[model samples]
Target: MILAVDIGTSSMKGGLITKEGYLFSYHRVRFPLESLKGDFSFSTELWSQGFLEILETLGASKVSVVAISGNGPTMVAANAQGKPLSPALMWNSDLGDSSIHSSSYYLSKINWLRENEPQLYEKSDLFLSCPEILYTQLTGRSVMVAPQEGYIPYIWSDSELERFHFRKSAFPEIVHMGSVVAPVSENAFLKTSLKPGIPVVACGSDFIASLIGSGAMKPGRICDRAGTSEGINYCASAAIGDSRVRELPHAVKGLVNISAILSSTGSLFEWYRQLTGQEKNNYKETMDGVNAVPASQGHPFFFPSMKGENLWEFKKGLFSGLEPGQGKFELGRSVMEAIGFAVRRSLEIFEELDLPVHELRVSGGQAKSPVWNQMKADITGKTMLIPEIEDAELLGCACLAATALGIYNSVSEASEDLVKIKHEIHPRKEFSDIYDIKYRRYRRACESVVSFYRDYPVSE
Candidate 1:
């Protein structure tokens, strides 16, 4: 068995998977992503504690190989002695200029650190993403696992790097995804009691791992993780060359992947629960109403705007068309409907790049809800492929490890052999027909909202 782990925005996850792709056991540890003023971050200490907790749960399994994947373009600054110098700049943190997208996001954040925290910046030894930072903890060696684009450790142009005054030395050595970074050190062995000298592979980012784990490696395939934020990722023949999508090199090597962000989806639901004093029973109670409500409720339209994506500017979340007698249930249904509509809207942008979305391989907290999944299918008019496992990201890391250990010829093949499709949810004709009318209304609502933001710029 190989141990595959990854650092997530809200938690750390991994498990032991057999060479053939069977996941034997798994574990997770959540860490606090604190907010300071308006910015968000999680420190290296929290991440380390999470990692060690996961290792402690694994109980010293003798693994053939070790690999890690993490979300990015998050920045983790480390001091010369390898201690964390600053809380990681999460992918969603706003660095004052909402103008900056993935093209120069990491550079901008690193620049912010250098300017705002010069003392910490000057003492910084490296700016590694979560994967490299976590792997370095295990091996006592550091190497930045390169992402194709959309993520940091990307192929940084010297001019672009200089534009942000990015510190070249602050970055770790670049290495290809799945490369054997180094052997595990004795110090790491003491923490977990695993044998020393195990080859550690620097698996790519978490988003790519989600694709592999869901078997969405081919072009037109999408791996959607509808959790805290909605991640809409699809494989493409080449870069769409559109800002609407964040492009990255695929784990398959030849193809590329384009990811779109919703900034809010599941989190919107959680926020509503908090507002309604239903935090403890949010899922069960809201889902009850979700099932009770049918397609095309024709209620209010909700716009989730907390985490703005590539195309739209950050604006306030809005709920329109409210009337008397429409209570929290209607609000809940509207949130669900809006989530579906927002997904379709994002896909329209993908289609503009000529990257037709074939199917959505979805996994996350939202994936457990058949009602929402059906709503998504009806709204998007595409089939939803739900994986057998809840942790596709962790499974994706397993695919990377399998590839690194020669267990599979490629990540694509590993996914095919191992990733099982539990069920496929197809679009229902009746629901689609109703959603057609509601979708048209949704389009108009979005246009109005965008126009409002344009006229009155919050300047986010």
Candidate 2:
């Protein structure tokens, strides 16, 4: 059995998986709200606590190897003994124009630390990503897991580090995904009660792991990992250059991943629930509320995101074309429809780039809703495939561990053998036609808003 764990944006999730890919047990621990304050960063100690609690809850007696994946480019500055010296600069953190290497997000954070907090930067021995820090805690080794050599520029290269005047010693040695980082150390054993000599395998960013876990290894397949934020990642043969989307190296050796991060998707739903005082409502109740209104019902056009694809400028969340008779059911349906439209806009970009997006392998919090699933399919005019395990990151970690332990020859092979789709939601022609017209209007509204913002700048 493999003890697969993922440190997510809001929580830490762990699962016990067999070589065959069956999820036997699962546990989750959400980070305290108090820890998440200021500039969208959090203390790395939350991860430390989350790991210990998850280990105790899962009780990994039969676990042979541990594999970890985490949300990143979250950078953590730590000492030689793996103790974090400062709060982790999270993936979404905005440090304006501080980067010497403008193209690399990870390097920008390092540069920000060096420029703003010289003492802390000078004291730090290693600058690691989220997963590397956790893996370091488990194995007493610090290493960066690069997906491939193609990703070196996006992360860091020796020349780029020199050009940016970053000390190479501050960065850990880069290793490939699925490589053994180190054994669970004696100190880790004393802290968490895990047996020594168990190899800790390195997995890539949570987005890559989710793609692997969703079995979207082949070109043309898209992995729509929807959680607090959403990542619509399209696997492709080569990188696409676009200002609207980012193209990064895929977990598979030669292929690339063209992705657009929807900064907020599932969080939009949560925000609606909270604002409307529907926090106590269960999933069924929430879904029921959204479902009460049929697809044909008239509702206001909702732009869910407060900020558009251009993360620098703030965008308005508008409820345009609202009718006097409309109520919460109409509003609820529109909120979900807005999410679907946001996803569709992203897919339209892939379409414009002539990338094949036959279907979306959907995973995360939003996958559980049948209405939302079908709505997404209808809006995007693509199929939605829900895997048996919606938390693909955990399963992806298991695939890495299985491959590392020689249970499978490759991560791709393990992913193929392990991933099982439980449901396939196809687009309904009637709803697709309606959504097609609505999407056009939505795009127009978005363009108008962007034009307005461009003309009358909001002072920062």
Candidate 3:
């Protein structure tokens, strides 16, 4: 059996998969994020504890392999021994930005790093995402960041190591995604009540894994990942040479993945919940109320830039179109509509790149809401499909591990063997027309706000 784990910003998920791609057992646990004046952070100890606890629950009987996937671009300062030097700077953490001008500005931030953290940056032997770091601590071996696990130590040729200014000794020997890292350490087994020598593989990033899990491997396919933030990722054989479209590192060689992310989605809803104190049985109840409201037609258009707009230089969040008599439901619907419209804007850019969007695979916590999924489908004018397994990220990691262990010939083959589509949500012509109008308004609001900021800057 192979163990697959997804370590996300808010939670950690684990699953036990058979060699044939069937999942046998699964577990999940939530962890808190520490927010201090908008600088988000997570305790490394908390992460470690969550993993250990999950392993203890799995009890190590039927598990033979382990694979890991995690949130990306999360910066961690690790010591020479591969231990964390400080709390993980989460992907959402804005504290690392050197200045307000640097926030949400990727190139400027990179330049800032070169100037400010030059020494630490130069000595940065290994700059890995959360999953890589976690796997390193578990296995006591180094693996170069690559798509396939088999290509690890051999792929990181001496030249490649030097190019990254990394020492051969400091780098972890690469193990394929399903390859066994080591016998669970004797000490670890004793503490966690698990047998040792379980094979651990290098699963890729959470988004990539989720896409695979959602069965969105073919070109022209798209997946809308609506979590705290919304990320619209589509598979394309051709490269999109736009700064807005982030070209993600692929586990597979010679293949590229492109994504356009809207930094706020469900987060806006959460903010509304906090402000209104609307009591609901759960997220479903909250969304049902939102679904009852009509498509908004008024001022108070939200910028949906809670984390700053990804494709622009703006850094501040904005809200417009506030008026009396606007109840919580309108406010909630507007936030939902704003997010859907943001996604529509991203699709417009994708269309401009001439990328074909054949279908959209929707997943994540927010996908549970028919309202949100329908809203997204209407706004993008594409059919949205949900997979039988909602936790595509976890399944994607497992599939990678299975392929790495030679259980499957390739990642695509494994994805086909495992992932199953559960439902389809098609766009309604009427709703699509409504969304067209709202989307135009959304753009106008965005442009107007950006113009206002440019002409009349806000005091920092």
Candidate 4:
């Protein structure tokens, strides 16, 4: 059996997968996000403890292989001995803001580290993601930093590393996802009830894994990831030449993956729920209420950038033209419409780049909403497909394990076998026509607000 673990934003999930592509037993444990003022982070120690507890409950004898998929773009600074210097800055955390975006910023932080916590930084050998950090903690061995496509220090080539004065020794050696990092150590055996020598495979980022798991193997196929943060990813034979598209690492060689992120999607709905004092019920009820209401003729534009935008602009959210007693359902519908519009805008960029987009595969928490799915289909004017597995990210990791175990010849072949289409949501002609207008309005709103946010200086 293969053990697949997904270290998510809010919780951790473990699944036991059989050789025949069957998911047997799954376990989920919730962990708290530590928010110290504006700095959001997660406790590495707590995560380690949680893993041990879950393994103990699973009974070590039942598991054979271990694979991990985790959130990305987040770095954990660690000492040469594999000890953490501080709480991990999660992918969602913006603690390093400018420092994360610029190499010069890192230099500044290094100076600050030297002044404030020099000893800790001195001991630190590398800044790695959760998977590398966890692997070191578990096996007392270091694994290489996987190449992430875009954002912060572009994938460091050998020359680029020299230019940046980065030490290769400080970075772990790169290993392909699903490659065995280390055998289960005596410490791991005592911490978890698992037997020794089980191979642990390092999985890729959740988004990349989800694309692989979604069976979007052929070029031009796109997947809409409507979770806490919305991501529209498409598989291409070649990397997008456009500046707007973010080129990311693909598990399969030669094929390139490009994505546009919304920075907020389900998060907007969550905010609406909290604002209306309806936090208890599922989002289905809220979406259902919106579906009952007619599409607003006025087409009140909404910019759904609740978590400071990406892809378009970095600004707080906005809802324009709110009349007194406009009804919460209208507001909710507007939010959904806004999200759909944002996706459409992203697709427009793909169109400009001449990227082929044939089918749309939808997944994540938002895929559960029929209303939202329909809206997305109409707005994009493409058939939206939902896979049999809701958590494509987890299944993607499992697919890698299947390949490593030789159950399938290749990642693409394993994806073809494991991914099954659940259903298709086709676009409604009338709804599509109406959404065309709303989408145009959304673009105009974005153009109007972008310059203001970018140029206007705010008082400190």
Candidate 5:
């Protein structure tokens, strides 16, 4: 059996799986990451605790190798003894004053620690991204991810490291995502009953896992991993020179990964669910509410802004053009439309770059909603491919694990065998113009108020 763990944004999930890709038992555990909302600070301790909890709860056994993946572009400072120096600055942390983008940059956080906690920084052993931290925690070895393996910090050259006034020595020994770092050590055994010296396969970002799992390695394909946050990625045969989307080198050599993130899509929906209690814990009623009603027809336009960055300003989400006596259902429909509009916005940007989206492979929270999936298809006017597996990212990690154990000839083969498609969603031609107009209105609404927020970004 193989153990695959995904350290997600809000939770950690893992399971025991047969080498042939059959999941024996699955489990998930959500950590209290919101304890520090200011910087999204989370206890590094919860990572291991959560992993062990999953292992014990599932009663997993015979784990030949473990492949772990997590959120990245996040910064974790470690001391000489491989201890975390501070609470991890999560992927969405907004504490950066240099620039909003700088906040997510690993190097920037290193400098911040050097200034703010110089004493700890002095004793710090190395800095790591989220995935590497988890891998090192189990393997009892500190290392940096090879540039080609992860999404962020694409710069690993000596000259580039020097440019930041950071020495390459301050980082872990570079390792590729699929290679074995080492067997689990005695330290890992102290927490769990798993035997020591089992090869620990390296994994990269959540996006990395999903891309391989979605089978979006081909050119002109797109993977819409719409989870807690929405990441729309386009796999291209060559590097796209457009600045509209951030690019990562794909797992398949020479494939350029073009992607964009909607900071508050699914999260905004969860927020609304908690506020309205329309359907209680799940989104069935909310999605049903959206489909049961016609388009708002410009009555309500939602910004869907929750800590939006890289824009001219920072603004919270709002429902504009609300009328008197608008019920919770109306607000719910508007929010759904708002999220669909956000997807359209990302598709439009990708279109502008001439890498028109041929098909959108949708995963995560939105895939559970056929209504929401169809709405995205209609709004974006693109075919939507939904995977049979909800945990594409975890399955992707499984693919990496299997490859490391030589279960498959290559990553491509592992994905082809493991990642299966459930169905495809097509646009409703009848609703195209309705969404077309609403998307235009959504854009105009954003333009009208963004400048105000830009000038006065202070939160009230």
Candidate 6:
């Protein structure tokens, strides 16, 4: 059996999988509220606790290999012994630059530490990403996991390191995903109850793992890994150099992953529910209210963002076409519609770039909502594929472990063997036609916001 784990922002989820891809058991552990600080920082100890707790819940004797994935480019300054010197610098932490085009921004976190917490910075032996820190703790080896050579620039290029004036020694040796890092150390075994000889396989960032787990390994397949934020990962054969989309190497070698992120898909729904004083209402009730409001040409429209050409130029959300009788239900429907429209716009950008989206493999919390799933299908005019394992991140780790252990020839092959489609939602022509017109209006309203913002540019 393989022990697969994915470390998330607020929580960690893990599961056990057999060599044949059967999931034995799964568990999740969340960081205590007290450990998570308001400044987008959290104690790294929470990760160790979560790992041990998961192991406690799922006994480790039968586990042959361990594969772990985590969120990044979150940086953790650690000592020579793989002990954290301070709280982790989260992915959302302000590191002076908000750009994701390069890894210089992530290095800025280390710079911030040097300037603010000079003592800890000087004491640190290396700065590691979220998952690498945990791997170091388990295997007593400090290394970085870069999905491919192209991704090295997005992590730490030699030029970026020189430009930032940081010593290369502060960084770990770069390793590709699925490489056996090392055997679990005796110390880790004593602390976590696992044997010391288990091989620890590298599973890159959570998003990459989700891409593999969702079976988005082939060109034209897109993975909609939705959570608080949504990532539309479109796998392609060639890398695209476009500002509208970010391109990186796919988990499967020789493939490209062109992606865009909607920063507030699921979170926006929750935000609207809270703002409308429906906080007490359950998710089903809120979505039910949204479903009751019929989708029509006259339905209220909403624009959840006012982003311009620049990714950082996000302003206030706009709610257009509100009427006298319209209340929470209308507004709620508009929110859902806005989310759908946002997804369509992203796909349109991909289409323009010649990366045609064949279908969407939907995963995450929003995948549970059939109403939203159907709305996404109708709005995007693409099929929605719900995988048997909705938590594809954990499954992705399983794929990595399976590949590392020679259970499969490669991660893509492992994914093909393991991932099974549970349901498929096709677009309804009636709703698609209505949404096609609504989508045009949504674009126009977004253009209006851009023009308005240009005339009266926002102040930072």
Top TM-score prediction, candidate number: 2
> In candidate 4, which residue pairs get closer than 3 Å at backbone N, Cα or C atoms, i.e. clash?
144-172, 144-173
Worst 10 residues of 5 by lDDT: 306-315
Q: What is the lDDT of residue 342 in candidate 1?
A: 75
Per-residue lDDT of model 2, residues 1-460, tens digit only: 8899998887889988888888888998977756544263588888888887888888868788999999888888998768899988888777624537366668888888888888999999999998898788778888998877777677788888888788899888999889899999988522677888899999968888999899989998889998778889998998878888987888888998889877767666766787777867787787887888887767887865335554212135667788898877688888888777778878888999998678999987788788788889999999999998889998899999888888899999999999999989999999899888888887777777666767876566
lDDT of 3 by residue, 1-460 (tens): 7777888776788877766556677788777534312233467666667777777777567777777888765656555445765556566766454432321222222333446666655665554457777666766555544455333442345565455444455444544444445555554412444555666676746877887777778777777876666678877776767887877544455556778877656556666787788634477878887777777456466665533345222246666778997777777777776777777778878888998675688878876678888888888898888776677887787787777777788888888888878798899999899878877766766776767777888777
Best candidate per lDDT, number? Answer: 2
What is the descending TM-score order?
A: 2, 6, 5, 1, 4, 3
Which residue window of length 10 is worst by lDDT in model 1?
A: 306-315
Could you list the CA RMSD of all candidates, in the order they appear?
3.5, 2.5, 4.8, 3.9, 3.5, 3.0
Runs off by more than 4 Å, candidate 2: 37-41, 96-99, 305-314, 323-327, 451-460
Note the clash tally of each candidate. 0, 0, 15, 2, 2, 0
Alpha-carbon lDDT of model 1: 0.73
- TM-score for each candidate, following the candidate numbering: 0.87, 0.93, 0.83, 0.85, 0.88, 0.90
Candidate 5's C-alpha runs over 4 A off are: 36-40, 96-104, 147-170, 187-190, 277-280, 296-299, 305-314, 444-460
lDDT on C-alpha atoms for all candidate structures: 0.73, 0.83, 0.67, 0.69, 0.73, 0.82
Ten contiguous residues with the weakest lDDT in model 3: 102-111
Prediction 5 TM-score vs. true: 0.88
- Cα lDDT of candidate 3 equals 0.67
Task: Summarize candidate 5's per-residue lDDT along 38-156 as a digit string, tens digits.
Answer: 37367877777888898788764667788888886677887644567788877777644363133135666666777677776677777887777767777778765542544434524
| Residue 222 miss distance in model 4 (angstroms) | 1.4
Candidate 6 per-residue C-alpha lDDT over 1-460 given as tens digits, one digit per residue, 9 for 90 to 100:
8899988876898888887777799888966646544244689888888888888898899789999999887888888667888888887666544332354436767777877788887878989988898888898888989776767767787777777667788888889888799999997522677889899999978999999889998888999998757889998999889988887778777888899888667667767887999977778988888888889836677766566632212237677777788889889988888888778888889999988776899987788789889999999999999988788888899898888888788888999999888999999999999889888877777788778877987677
Model 3 bad stretches (over 4 Å): 18-25, 35-41, 56-59, 78-83, 94-128, 148-169, 174-179, 278-281, 296-300, 306-315
